[model samples]
Target: MNWKIIFCFTLLSMLETSSSSKIYNVDPSGYVLYCPCMGRFGNQADHFLGSLAFAKALDRTLALPPWVEYRYGEPKSVQVPFTTYFKIEPLESFHKVMPMEDFMEQIAPTVWPPGNRTVFCYMPRGNPDSESCNAKEGNPFGPFWDTFDVDFNRSVFYGPLNYDVIHHNMGDAWRDKYSSEDYPVLAFTGAPASFPVQEENRRLHRYLEWSDDIDQRAEEFIRNALPKGAFIGIHLRNGPDWERACEHIDSTPSLFAAAQCLGYRNEYGRATQEMCLPSRETILQQTRKAIKDYSAKSIFVASDSDHMIDELKKEFKRMNVSVHRMPNPVPQVDLAILGRSNYFIANCISSFSAFAKRERDIKGIPSGFWAFPQKPQNIQNSSSRSDEL
Candidate 1:
């Protein structure tokens, strides 16, 4: 027997053993993947939170996609990264986060079998005539693929996906099914509305918390712009689009009683303004009440329309309360400031406002939806509004 040949055989056997052990040690949870699909920061944030909750329920890894560029006519180049806008470390212990490119190029193919990728559409559980879903189909946001310039369908699981309708009754089933799947990769599309509202909010508080930069900027703005006292944060969601939405709720004031707006569908076939958008009078009244009740010396206003901000400034000034608005406000900055407020007045239908409220809830700060008729004394007992569309 050749001694050199014997030594080579032994080395080969050891290498094979090591590889087998490593393959067995790979964690299934690490293979779980999620790609966020939606428009704007608020909608994307909702999708992120919903995906995060689903990931938590099933113990899957969430691949944070680049922010959707819904504002531009089409999905342009993604300049911002996920960690830039949100804190990823808080969720690292329980779930994993990865770049969309890595998930698409490296992880997805290995985990999911060919032609078996799953797409979970996050629409309202039971409502067939959901406007948000319709809008998503009509006006698709984000680039087709995770990595720029790649063929969307080929790069990842993109096609007529096998739709798993996620509604109130379907969460547990989906979780169990996904958890038991043999494949390593699981892909989801649409905005996040799979879990129950309360569960989603709890998870949102945990994962969607802002990054330190956002936190620092918000604090600096508050320190410099706001007076030295408790402040109220108000989300005045009024604009041409919202104004039209308000008409959906104009005839149905009863629907405004709840924190989450729900009622008959509008022309767009989704929740009407009656369910989400409050009247201007209602906004003004609520702001005044919030200021007085919370004993706030200043008010921070986040609005889509500059006209609305100016009006709030004059109105708040008349009431002898200082008004603060971000100069050329961005969504993340506005949200950060709103979260730090002593008391938060959220727009009933706006996901943007809902995001802030969730942050405040995590911090044990009080918040209320402007459209909620029955104002609660404390935030913990706040109205049960469905923030997701």
Candidate 2:
């Protein structure tokens, strides 16, 4: 055989061995990339007429795996890629990674010419034979694909994926695997349009769309922060951060304002503060005990009530407990964090308080009274008297 042919045979033989790590949990994944430029001029023209219909990006695409998957491929999870994204990119947003299968068809039903799908990328605009500078720097609009390592024309590690893991990719390290018959239907590299990503759309994209891409990441964080045996996420909506939550709780007249709930009284001759919005004193007492319970790690406060939080902390001088608050001021997605908790502690009156309970009911997570009126009947009677006055 020719020397070149003989050398090729030897390379294949060596590749089959050394790099085989025991593959256990195989995470399936695929791409869903898009950007403001590059998916659809259909050609590199200075005067292309038509709305830059990027949604048409998927017209040439196909379906995805039941669940998308991604390996860390490397350490270090991605931080907010853009600044001011704290608001633009919610904290809990990227922390979750899910299977691609979760979002099958997200296109709203009523849009005209009703054929669309998720993971839609931009259409190709440059010359098929060569990268067109016109496509790179088009007129009033912009380039068709301008969001990658263009500084160095070399291929990018994650931009419009060049290879699938299950499949072959010139024997590259980041190679992906895809079915023999499967291949990428579409790919693009750029920032998507400036249209406001609808609320529901953004939610679907973050938690549902990019989920599989970061599944390993989300799971690891969830596990490290909260081990999976059992947990009860008690949401306290609208409270200030911990320092503020504690300070607000300190101001309440009742030592256990939030604690004087209506459920069965404990050994201290007091009622449990399960779901009712009580005084800050109640929150203080319960917070301290939460530290000692060994039953629970931390309590989730979900309210926007700034004053109530610090007031509640005042009365809890005896117990050592820590409060974990989402760094965000206004949370867009209702906290599903509560349902993940072992049992729940909700405020009696507020709908926000019940968000956790509702999620628990849906997911079949068991929950119990975490707060209530200290004396339901008496409290009602007192309220009635006050009304008469």
Candidate 3:
């Protein structure tokens, strides 16, 4: 027997087995992991819809990012897990779910390719002065998503070696180009606000169900605060920051209003005070009309200003109306209660209000913006007419 021949054949067989093992262990159905970059709860909701739609379109598993921790006095940060606020499905259903740390330490070395990777830079960039750059040219929803390259060490490349960037406004044509089997792992990042609002709402309803705790809290708040009948929900955004932002909307009505609050302006322009801040009288009138039109017995007011709520209470009292607010003052609780209302009135330029509106729309509840009529220069005296609710 030739021992040298046998030894060589055995070594060759071992190499073949090792190669086959590596090939078999690699995941064929890559995942679509995304990190939602900005915005609070509502903005994150919009991003969630975009990521979910992108994942579905490519037939990839969706990995959720941590929520943005917004402090009152401090800078905003993203350190909290998304599941901390909402109840997402278990990670077992997806291709993979892990913290950014786990992805870097364990998954990256295994999945990421040995060289540069593709990054779908979803952030839009162009000269502000040019109309052609500003217009939606390639994608209908604007230049929301673009592809670029970055080293594998970058945080955005949290998945496989080879990936495809699924930008916000890439359209159906781009999404149709790829499938789950095409890559070992795919990742997405950025706030995906360019997806269709209706489709976004539909996916949101399907994927991101509120946590049980949130649901219970909402139910309890509604039971304790609202009267036992069809009620009206109102989101009055009058925070100090909102006051300034409202002016932007008022001054640039052609740009902001026409763009549905999605467009940007380089300059801070001036507008009528009425356009920026709705007068207290305007709030009262709008609330009164909502209560009358809906035949609602109770009104749930969600606002950042407690003083405004107190003032509203006195006015509602004068009109023989019942007004209620959440005792805890949590945004999620307020949103849940508002969503359950029979009707809702919202500030047009508010994402928080928009969030509630989307939730209500999902339930087929009627809702409209609280259109404040411009104040007349001569009308300085307060009217004494009080309509009974």
Candidate 4:
């Protein structure tokens, strides 16, 4: 053969190999896809940890779903990549994880082609006559799938069966029901995890390392903005919406993510108005005690509504305990800073607070709920040396 002909053929073969390599990277065992289409960041984060464990138990590659954000002035939900706030490297040590966007761009075409996609759920939702999964029927659900240009051709209502992979038999049940060879992709309408999160999966928070940018910003804020001495970080969930929810706190044994503080068995304490929406006086009282007990020189407040930072500053002014809050709050940075604090007191019924509380627990840092355990003296004691907080 002529040398010129040989060169053209070699180049063409190399191009073909490059295209094939992308498909080869796909896991032969299949994939686990889901939409973090629930509440805001905290709820999604809690579900994510459980879903991560679920994927490992099934021996499938977990597709890391994006963090669905609802920005002001934006009519539709914004899907931020899972890697936007966290590092995947730490997570991979636990199980195989690939960003959903990466899978959609590279592996999806080969493994899950268009017109063949199926949405999986516990059962058909909405109309009784209809057998639709209605996966993309809600706010974040529709936006989340749209982000990936994903449209399901069918729905799989794999019910009477659930996503409780805690028991060894549950995993066996799943494997027995749906084999990887037959069902290559298990795309869930929502996260395959429970709310308030399971006790076993809560420990998985260790694998969720913040992105370098978020970590650096938190460190810099602490070093430059906060006072020289140790600071107490606190989360307050007292928005208008919280006020409405707190109305039934008496009847509600556990509200929102109270399980993180109250314990799943309620061994700690049931949810209280003080824990859900503490009065300003109560907050001040708790803050003062935290400062005195921990010898904290400053306070950093994270909240959904107005954090009353000015009020805190005025009260603590005489004591010279500096008070602060993020100038432009980024939720991930707030959690990172809270996790690094000397001590943390958080809203017992807020999932947002649960994220920080869980992080502090994993690091052996003391954390407490606003007025939980009902006694001021027992606040620090109850939280001391316990990961349950």
Candidate 5:
């Protein structure tokens, strides 16, 4: 009755389907996985936008990392989801994105097991003899990856290359070197984008809208603490650490986040102590000018240290302007309020300031750096690309 032939056909069908079985839970297009373990929230946000652009350029889905936080009481840094502070839809409008927690839960088991995952880096970042990516050796690196129970057993050194993914042929380089068919996930030890952020990616900040909670907190602060009319928002970086850093500004031409304001090529004049840590007088003078220009009725100051709110209050008394700051300040809330201000002034050398500055720039709102443009001629050119980021 041809029973043997029927059995053979059945066996052949089983083998064919087994051969096509999916090895990865993710798509063949692959995923761009990275830790936003660079700096504070502002720096992380900067790197995040660049990473988003990188993923879009490579046509890969980005694993959105949590915002790393180092609070006062916490011994180790806390990992907060990207969605905790910002909405995901705006990021998806640019390209595909998935929260890191989701990727770990749904995809990691099939594509990247704890034993087989490899850490990718631009080049050797650890000891020369070790010649490893050393993905989890440091503070946020260890805490950030550990939060998702991720452990990389091997390292892939990808260079004579840099993360100038916008200008250079970096997408091609990455795709050619690490094909999705072979490597389902390219998990970078750090962000796969340039620091100080690329000028091309500056406009990407517009997509980073705050979550409902963050926006609500900011709105509540504005309604309760600030005056009724338009207000001038200013970010002051005068913490003990910032004060120490500003002391060396004379010797260092290129410092943290200065490239965002001074121009990556220094076309907008080099950074100065005045720009990094403006005096109380300088702050008052600039606040006065901004208030006059925007007809602001109040001032909102966000600072890392004791910003002397009383002194500011006294200085603005004659002008009939009120000064305010949060009782227990939240940086995200501060940034959200800053973005909503009629005018914003921020430090040239601070990444926190850079965050607000970039956001305002995207909204076509006026933004000025503290103690910048010492000469009238130093004003940034309206058409110059250097004016960006």
Candidate 6:
């Protein structure tokens, strides 16, 4: 009987373990997680990771970044995770990330009562999209808020953890077009506030067991594929069919015409639709201006735009200009490719592109953004590409 119990315990531990080679000692500080989101546009971890960064940024006077570690019930509404991959008791939920709509907006501490490091709460798969990404069939967040009320949140909110920008460069004399609300100012010092980042970036080394050799191969892909010098990177990943994307390519005018079908709208004109993604020509033109403005810089490109890249290669060859492949190990096969470079030029609506270049990959505050003239800061902004860094 003892042998049976011992064997069962051993088997369960093996199954529950996060890995095979090395066991991860869960951090006592606990993990801040943003799970996959609604538009499901951002990565799975931003909500958590961004909170981590923002929390560190707050001074005594600053309100906490808009967040709640994963939790259960509230004044109303079922527990927050009835739809997400919220492992109750053993885990937590999150809050709906607040948008910075005004430059003068301020982040205040939780009116939601405080807890330290305890998982916050928020349901992900329901009403709007419903059971899409991490939802476990129907028990989204576990049937109801009443579940896990005893086990979870009982720990207490860490209030806010260490959150701040390790390094940040908002703007210089040349460019200062940011709005107040977009990134807004913090509580006390009133310096520009740090916003949310995905939990993925910081937890990456822990979640992913990518090998050093995998990283090496990804590096080779970039070295052999990219062009020389400081070039502008154009990342066009938002599309219906990845394979047929190249065929639809023409001048930027045509892409602008397709509009939403292209998976992006000119964000600045978010409510309207004036600044749709600049046509290919418009983007190239802007890129040229950006490059010229910041000389001694070369584009080291990397994106999922195979079709667009192939076309650029042909165009470069025809014009006798140099270009690089930039494409490397596919995201599905190798996650390490993300570790190669910290900078990017993202497409409007492609969360993959957004998730890739976001603070998760680079580990910083919302340093610089790139979007259209009327782009909404919640989703889009137009700062210099890598140059903004």
lDDT of 5 at 289: 91
Locate the minimum summed-lDDT window of 10 residues in model 4. Answer: 380-389
List per-prediction Cα lDDT, in the order shown. Answer: 0.58, 0.31, 0.53, 0.83, 0.81, 0.32
Which runs in model 4 stand beyond 4 Å of their true positions? 1-24, 375-389
Stretches of model 1 off by over 4 angstroms after superposition? 1-26, 72-79, 101-182, 191-204, 250-275, 374-389
Candidate 5 matches the true fold with a TM-score of 0.88
The residue-by-residue lDDT of candidate 5 on 140-200, one tens digit each, is 8999899988888888888786677777798898889888888889899888876677888
TM-score for each candidate, following the candidate numbering: 0.68, 0.30, 0.64, 0.90, 0.88, 0.40
Worst 10 residues of 1 by lDDT: 262-271
lDDT of 4 at 262: 72
Better of 4 and 6 by lDDT: 4
lDDT of 6 by residue, 237-284 (tens): 433353243233322322311221222233433312222233566545
Judge candidate 1 at residue 107 and give its lDDT: 43
Q: Write the per-residue lDDT of candidate 1 for residues 1-389, one digit (tens) a residue.
A: 69899867745654554312211223466444443444456656655666666555555566666675445454454436676787666767556666554454444444653455444344422246542222213223334343433222222222232223333434455545545454355544454443224333444565666778988999899999999998988887777766664554534332222333322222112333533666678788888888889888988888887437666778888667888798878789998988888898887567677678767777888887765544233222222232223
For residue 37, give model 3's deviation from the true position in Å: 1.9
The count of residue-pair clashes in candidate 3 stands at: 3
Residue ranges of candidate 6 with Cα displaced over 4 Å: 1-18, 21-41, 48-135, 138-214, 241-276, 290-306, 314-320, 326-329, 332-344, 348-350, 356-389
Error of 3 at 152 (Å): 5.2
Collision pairs in model 4: none
Q: Model 6: how large is the Cα RMSD against the reference?
A: 15.7
Ranking by TM-score: 4, 5, 1, 3, 6, 2
- Give the TM-score comparing model 6 with the true structure, all chains together: 0.40
lDDT of 2 at 352: 39
Which one wins by TM-score: 3 or 5? Answer: 5
lDDT of 3 by residue, 1-389 (tens): 59999767745654554312211223345556554544556656665666665555555445555665455664334356555566644333432333333333334455655463333333322553432222223221122222111233222222222222343444344444444444445554453334223332443554456778889998987787677877888887777766766555533442222112222231222223453356787777887888778778878888876436677777777656688887658888788888888888766455567677666766787877655333333322211111000
Which pairs of residues clash in candidate 5, taking residues 3 or more apart in a chain or in different chains? none
lDDT for 192 (candidate 1): 40
